[model samples]
Target: MMFMKSIFALAAFATAVYAQSVTIAAPVEGTSVTAGQNFTVDIARPNTLSPSQEVAVVIGLVSCSEAPFNGNCASFDVSQIFGTILYNGPYTPTLHNGPSPDFIDFYQNFTLTVPSWFTPGSASLNVAHVSLIGAGPFPDLEVKNITLNVVAA
Candidate 1:
């Protein structure tokens, strides 16, 4: 009986540890574009455990400059145009001490309404990290992925 009780306690602890993680999938990059063309960027969060918990996503337009070193690029002049909180609907599962109980999905579309201010060349559509807070015991959360591209309009 004592051995059986210890095994059960261990299983419960492991389940709790696995239940509290928030994962943000990568954003799919759209194709090339003209200066005045309308473009759409699809941002998806396929899996979210704590959908009840709030998160802030900041999207910006930035210029990527090549560095002296190989395989390295630098970003500059981050212009913030879109920043908002994603509210996972009530049907979305709340983190109750295990991996996200349900799959959460959403998207955002951006059009190039601003006039050209930079030289004719290539730039990047950057999605800053997803900021997660007040979710269980985790103090903060951040995730990074590849930057998308935008041509001169």
Candidate 2:
């Protein structure tokens, strides 16, 4: 029981730490998802530190479900994706023009339907954003990946 408690404590601590950074909210690592299914790529920004005005938005769609996704998820590059951003924004995440980092709420959500053309194998979705501001935008890179398996019709 003591060991279990300790493990749980450690896990909680780790989760808390990870949540403080930009992250992927679904299609978790090492799992299998069916092709042609829609999946979400959710990225969250840390609470506001100061008044932040946006300058631009950056987006990338990662779908390397071919023969090379067998390696580490971090090894993939956003440049390999060939496409355009689904949206463009230039506003503060939550428009928190106050004095604390915990003064606002903002997040990015993208709905992705796995293209039928993607090869059935290991696949990944990567996300990152830099919200340019008068000072400097928060830098974040997040990714989620799942094995691409065919579903029985």
Clashes of each: 6, 1
Cα lDDT tens digits, model 2, 34-139, are: 5567666555556534444334344433445443545334555554653234344532344232246644546556665655555555444444444323234444
The CA lDDT of each predicted structure is 0.39, 0.47
Q: What clash pairs does model 1 have?
A: 18-99, 19-97, 19-98, 19-99, 35-153, 49-100
Best by lDDT: 2
Which stretch of 10 consecutive residues in model 2 shows the poorest summed lDDT?
A: 144-153
> Distance from true position, residue 37, model 2, in Å?
1.7
Model 1, span 6-95: residue lDDT tens: 999788645543343333333344345444455544444333344224354444443343332122223332333221212222213232
Query: Which candidate comes out best when scored by TM-score?
Result: 2
Model 2, 108: alpha-carbon shift in Å? Answer: 3.2
Q: In candidate 1, which residue ranges exceed 4 Å CA deviation?
A: 1-30, 65-104, 110-115, 133-149
